[model samples]
Target: MNASLSPLAILGIVAVYFAVLVLVSFLTSRNDSNNADFFLAGRKSPWLLVAIGMVGSSLSGVTFISIPGAVGAGGVNQAFSYMQVVMGYLLGYAFIALVLLPLYYRMGLTSIYEYLRSRIGPHAYKIGAFYFLLSRTIGSSFRLFLVAVVLQQFVAAPIGIPFAVTVASAILLIWLYTFRGGIKTIIVTDTLQTVCMLLAAGITVYYIAGALETDFSGMVRLIRQSDYSQWFFFEGGWSDPNNFFKQFLSGALITIVMTGLDQDMMQKNLSMPNFRDAQKNMLLFSIVLVFANLLFLCLGALLYIYAANVGLSLPASSDLLYPTIALINLPPVVGVLFVLGIVAAAYSSADSALTALTTSFCVDFLGMRETDVVPDTQAGTQVLEENTKRKRLLVHSGFSVLLFAVIMAFELINNTAVINSLFKAAGYTYGPLLGLFAFGLLTNFRVREEVRVGKVRIPALILVCLLSPIVSMVVDYYSAELLGGFQFGFLILAFNGLLTFVGLVTLSELGEPHGDDFTGTDYA
Candidate 1:
C-alpha cells in the first residue's frame, strides 16, 4: 500500500474543496434573492439537472458505505436484492407523478404538507410536517454520522483531528454550501456532487477490476460463477424476510414514504416547472437510482475480490469494508476519491433535509400559504410577504439548531445497529402520511372540523402503524422457537405501512353528508 500523501495533504485538499462549495453557494444564492429563490429555485429548474441531482440525493453516504458492506453479510441474494426495492421505486414514482405531483401543482404548494392542510385539517398538516422534521432530522444525522465514522477512521486519525471536530467540520461545510439558497443551490451542487460520487465509485470499480485482471464481461462471468449471484426470490415463503413479494411490497412502500410522501424528496419534485416535468424527473430518477445501485453492488463484489487477492484483512463490519480497502490496500488517490465520494453522498442528502425541514415548518406549521391570492396588487401583499419572510427565517434557523442537537445526540450514542433500526422505524412514521394522502386522493373522505385529536394524534397514528408489525413479529418470534428460527428484513416495513393504511381507512369518512364522492377535481 502506498502512503505517499500525508494526512496534512488530505486535510488541505478537503479544506480547499469546502471553500469552493461555500463560494458556489454564495454565487447561486446571489442569483436570486427571495424566499422563492431559497426554497424552490424559483421553480425554473431544468429537468435534466433535477434528475441528476436527485440521484445523489437518493443514495446518501449510507448507501455509499452500507450497500456495499451489506453484500458480504447478505450474500449475493440479500445484497443485490435491494435492487428489487429500487425497481419497486418505479411504482412509487408513478404514484408521485400521476397522483401527488398534479395535486401539488394544482394547489401551488411550497411544501407537500400543504396538501395535508387542504385535505384533512391543520392538525393533520402539522402532524405530517412534524413527522418529516423528526424523521429527516434523525435520518440525515444518521447518514452523516456514518460518513463521519469513515472520516474519523481513515482520514482524521492519521491527521490528528478529533472525531468530533471532523464531524462538525463536515457538517459546517454542508451548512456553508446550503444555507443561502437551500434547495436552489442544492439542485446545482447536488448535480455536481452526483458527478463526483459517480466518478469516485466508477474509478474505484475500474481499479478493482484491473487488479483482478478482469474486463466487464470477465467480471460478469466471475460474479455468475461465484457463490453469491442468486437473483430470483421465489423460494422464500411469505413468512420469509427476503421473499420476493415482501421485498417488492416493502420497496414500494418505502418509495412512497421516503420519496413520494416525505417533504425532503417531494420538494425537489415540486420545484419542476409543471406536473409533467416533475413526473419526468421522478421516472428518470427511479431509473437512475436502479442503475446507480447496480454499480454499488458491483463495486462491493470488486472490493471483496481485491481484498482476497491482496491478502488484506476484511473489516469486522461490512460498512467499513470500502473505506478500509481504500485506506489500507488501495493507492493514495483511491483513498482521496473515497473520502470525496463519502462527503458528496452525505451532503447530497443532508442539505436537502435541511432545506425541506425549513420548507415544511414554514409552510405547514406556520401557515405561510399564499392565502391572499388577489394578484399581489399592493403594499398589503408586501406586508404579508414580509411577515412570512420573518417566519421562514425563524423556522430555518430554529431547525438548524435542532439539527445540531440531533447530530450531537447521535454522536454520543454511536450505536450503528440502533441507528439502523431507527431508520426502519422512521419508515413506519411516514406510513400515516402515505395513508393520509392516499385517502384524500383515492376517496372523498372528508375529515370534518371540530374533531380534536390533540397532541397524541401523531403518536397514535405511529402506534397503529407499529402495532400490527409488532404483532406479526411476535407471531414470527414464537413460531421460530416452536418450528424453526425466523428473521425479518426490510419487508417488515410493508406490513407497518399497511397497518397505517388500514388505520386511515378506519378513521377516515368515506362520503360527504350532502354531496357526491370527491372526483379528484374538488381538490384540483
Candidate 2:
C-alpha cells in the first residue's frame, strides 16, 4: 500500500523552518554594530565558511530548474559540456589571484569599482558600478521570480496564498535576517542554506534512484551508457552551440566578468580576512563548484532516464523537470525535499545579491569611507562626521526598496527568455571595465596624461576597449547568421571581455607612463 503525506504537514514544516531562520537573525544583531558590520560582516569572516556559502549563493533557482531540463533539450552537450566552462573558471580564478586581488588588497577597497576611479577616471568608476547595479538588480529579481513561481505552484495554491503575497513574504524573510549583519550574517546563514540545499538534492536524488529501482552506483553506470555523457566538442566550428573554442573562451570570460568583476559575487570574496585568504577561497571555490555542477548535471540525466522509463511526456519547459519528476515519480518526502531545495537556491542567491547591491551603492557611488564604522583608532571619529549615520542608513534602505520594486516589476512580466537574453546582453557592458583594468595593470599606458584623444583626455586605448564589443556585435549580427546558431555558451562571458580589451587597445593613443616604474599601484 502507498502512503501519502498531508499538505498541512508540509506547510507547517516549512513555516517552522523559516521561523527559526528569522529568530537567528534577531539574535545575531548586536548594539555595537553599524553599517560596515551589516554590509561586510566586519570583514572578519572565516574564509572556508564564506567560500562554501558562496556555492549556494551562486546556484540560483534558475539552475535548480534548468539543469534537468537542459539534459533532455540538448542532450549531453547541454549537461556535460558546461564542464568545459568550469575549466575556464579555474583559469579565470588564477588571473584574479595573481592580478586583480593584489590591486584590490593594496587599495583597501570595499567596492571593487573604487579601483576604476584610481586607475581610469570617475567616469569609468561610475560606469562600472552602474552596469553592476543594472545587471545584478534585474538578474537577482529574475532568479527570485523563478523560485517564487515554484512556490506558488506547490505551497501557495493548496493554502490559497497569492503570488504577490508570497513574493513579498519571501523577500521580507530574507531581509529580516540579513538586513542587520549583511555579508557577515549571510556567510553563516548561507552555509546553513547550502547544506540544506545539498541535503535536499541528495535526498531527492536518492529517492529518484530508488523509484527507478537503481542504487547510486547503478545510476552512474546507467548514465555512462546514456546518450548525454559526452564532454568535449570541436567539430561543430564557431557557430555550433557546443563548439569547444566558443565554450572554452566563454568560460574564461564568464569567470572574469561574472565572478572576478561583478560586485555581487566579488563582495563575498572581499569579506575574507585578507587577500591571500580570499585567493585561497576563490581557488577552492572553483574546484568545489565543478563538483557541485556535476551533481546537478547528473541529476538532470537521471530525471530524463526515469521519465522515459515511465513513458511520461517531458514538460514543455526544461525548468519544470525537477519539480514534475519529484511530484509524480518519487514519494511525498522527495517532493517536499525538492520544493525546499528550490526555496533554498532562490533565497541563497537573491539575499546575497540584495546585500551586495546595497554594499556597492553605499561604498562606491555614495562616497562613504570603507572603514567608517570599524576604525583602527578614535581619530577615525572625525571622518565619520563627514556623513551622518542616519543619512547613510536611509541611502542603503531606500536603494534596497527600489531594487526590490524593480525586481518585482520584472517578475510580474514573466518572460524567461527575454530575461535570460537581457542577462547575456548585460554581460557585454562589463567589457569596458575589464579592458580598463587590463591596460592599467599590464601596460605602462598613462590614460589620464595622454592629451591626444580630444577633451576626455583619457587615452584612445581606453576608448577602443569601450567600442570593440559594440563593433563585434554589429559585425557578428550581420555576417554570422548564415553560418549556424552562434552558440553563445552561457559561459562565454570572456569573449565580451576580450572585445573590451580590443577596444581599449584601439582607442588608446601611443604613450608610455614610465614603463619600468609600473608597479600596478599608480592606477590604484
Candidate 3:
C-alpha cells in the first residue's frame, strides 16, 4: 500500500530546488557583491520578505519534522502544550520590538555585539561575539545534520554515497549560492523556501486526511476528542517539564536570548531600512509562527491517527515518525515534498547562519566595516576593498568547512530529536549572552575588564562568563535531589544567566553615568 521515491528522483528534485536558489543568488548579487550588500542588504530589504523568510528559518528542519513528531512524543512538548511557549514568544517579541529594536537601530549597528563593545567593554564585546559563534555553529550543525540523516537514509544509501559526501555536497550547495549574495540573496531564497515548506506540510496533511476518510471539520473533531488534545498542564507543579508556568516562562526567556540576543536572527531584523519596519516584521512573523506551529501539531495528531487506523508500526525514534510515514506509507509525491520541505527548512536557517557567522567574524574579529568606503577612483581604497573582500570570501569558505565537520560529528554522536538537543545546547551557550546583555541594559555598573588578583591580571568578564555556565550545569544535574525534585528543564538558561549576572556584579563598581551609557531613554 506504500510507494516511495527513487534515489534518482529525489536527487532530481533537490537539484532543481538548488538551481532556482542559485539563479536567485546570481540575480541578487551580480550587480552588487560588496560587503554592505552581503552583510546588511544595504539596509534596503523589504520587511514583508524578511518576515516570510524568517518563518522558514525559525522553523528549520527541526520544526519541519521534530515538532509534529513531538505532538505524539508524550514527553516535553506533548499534545498542545507547545502553544504555551508560542504565547510566551508573543510576549518576548513585544519586548524585542519595544526595547531591543530601538536600541540597535539608534546605534546603527552592523554587528549587534558592537553594542556590547560600546556599553560594556572590548572584552565583553568579544565574549558576546564568541558565544554567538559557538551557539550558531552548534545550532546550525544540528539542523543540517537532521536533513543529512534523512537524505542519507532515504536517498544516498540507495545510491551508495557515503554520509560524509552527502553532508559535504549539501554544505557545498549552500556555499555556492550564498557566498556572493549573502543576506540579500537569503531574503529572497528563504521566502521561496518558506512557501515550499508550508506547501509540503499542508499537502501532506490533506493526503493523511484523505487516508483517514475524514473531512477538515471531522479531523478537527477527532483531534479535539483524542487523548493528545490536552493543551495546558497545571497539575504537574514545579517538577513537571510540561508545567504551564515553567514552559511559558522558559519560552519567553528562550525567545529573548535566542532571537533577540542572537546575531543570526537579529541580522535579518537589522537588515531592514529602519527599526520600525523591523518591528513590523517581528510582529507579523511571530503571529504567523503561532499558526504554523499549530498546523504542525494538528498534522502530528493525524499521523498517529492514520497509523492506528492502518495498523502501521511506529518508528523507534519519534524524529523518524513523519519521515517514515511520508517516505514509506504515502504516495511518491508526498516523499518528494518531504525531501524538498526538509531541504528548504534546513537551508533557510543554515544559509543565513553561515552568512551571519561570516559577517560577525569579519566585523567583530577582523575589524572590517561596511562604512569604510572611499571614492571609486581612489586606488588605495580600491585595494583595501579588494583585500577585505578576499578576507570575507576565505572566512565564508572556512565556515562552510566547519559546518560540514560539525555535522559529521553530530552524525557520529547525535541520537535524540534534534529540537531537544538544540534547545538543551542553547541553555548552556546562549545563557552567558543573556546575562551579558541584561547586565548592559539594566545597570550602570562598569566591570573592570582586567582585575588584579594578587600579582596576576585576570580577564574578569571572561572568567565570569566562562564560570557561569559550568556552575549552572552542575546545579542543573543536582537540581532534582538538591531542590526536592524540581526540574529545571529549559529554565537552566535563566539560572545560568542569573549566575553570570551575580558574578559580573562581584567585579563591578558603580560609576557616574557617562555620555555613552545606555539609559534606556537616550534614543527616545
Number of the top-ranking candidate, with TM-score as the measure: 3
lDDT per residue, candidate 3, 1-524, as tens digits?
Answer: 13347888888999999999999999999997889899989889999999999999988998888888888888899998888888888889999999999999898888889899888878898999999999999999999898888888888998899999999999999999999999999999999999999989998999998898889999999999887898999999989898999899999999999999988899999888889999999999998999998988898889988888899999888888899999888887888888899899889999999999999999989988864566666887878878888999999999999999999889888777788889989999999999999899888998876888799999989999999989988999899999999979989999989888888888888894222343221221
Structure candidate 3, residue pairs in collision: none
C-alpha lDDT of residue 162 in model 2: 81
User: How much lDDT does candidate 3 score?
Assistant: 0.89
CA shift at 457, candidate 2, in angstroms?
A: 11
TM-score versus the correct structure, for each prediction: 0.88, 0.86, 0.96
Question: Which residue ranges in model 2 land beyond 4 Å of their true spot?
Answer: 1-11, 75-77, 373-389, 412-423, 448-479, 482-492, 510-524
The best candidate by lDDT is 3
User: Which ten contiguous residues of candidate 1 have the minimum total lDDT?
Assistant: 514-523
lDDT by residue for model 1 (1-524), tens: 24664567667767776777787788888865467776778788888899999999888887788887776666323546666766777787777788778878887778777666666655556667777777788788788778887777767887688877877777667766776677889898889889878888888887778878889898888777664465557786755655676667767777878888888988887777888888888878888888898898888777776777788888778888888887567777887887678888878888888888887776666655424233657887777766766676677667666766776777787655533454465654565666666666666665533233564334443344345556645554565575565544555455555665676556556566222212222222
User: Which whole-number lDDT from 0 to 100 does residue 44 have in model 2?
Assistant: 75
Candidate 2 structure, TM-score to reference: 0.86
Q: What is the Cα-based lDDT of residue 230 in candidate 1?
A: 55
Model 3 segments more than 4 A misplaced? 1-4, 374-377, 452-455, 513-524
For model 2, the local distance difference test gives: 0.70
What's the TM for model 1?
0.88
For residues 34-106, write the lDDT of model 2, one tens digit per residue: 6666655666778898789888887777667776577667732475776676677778888887888777777
Stronger candidate by lDDT (1 vs 3): 3
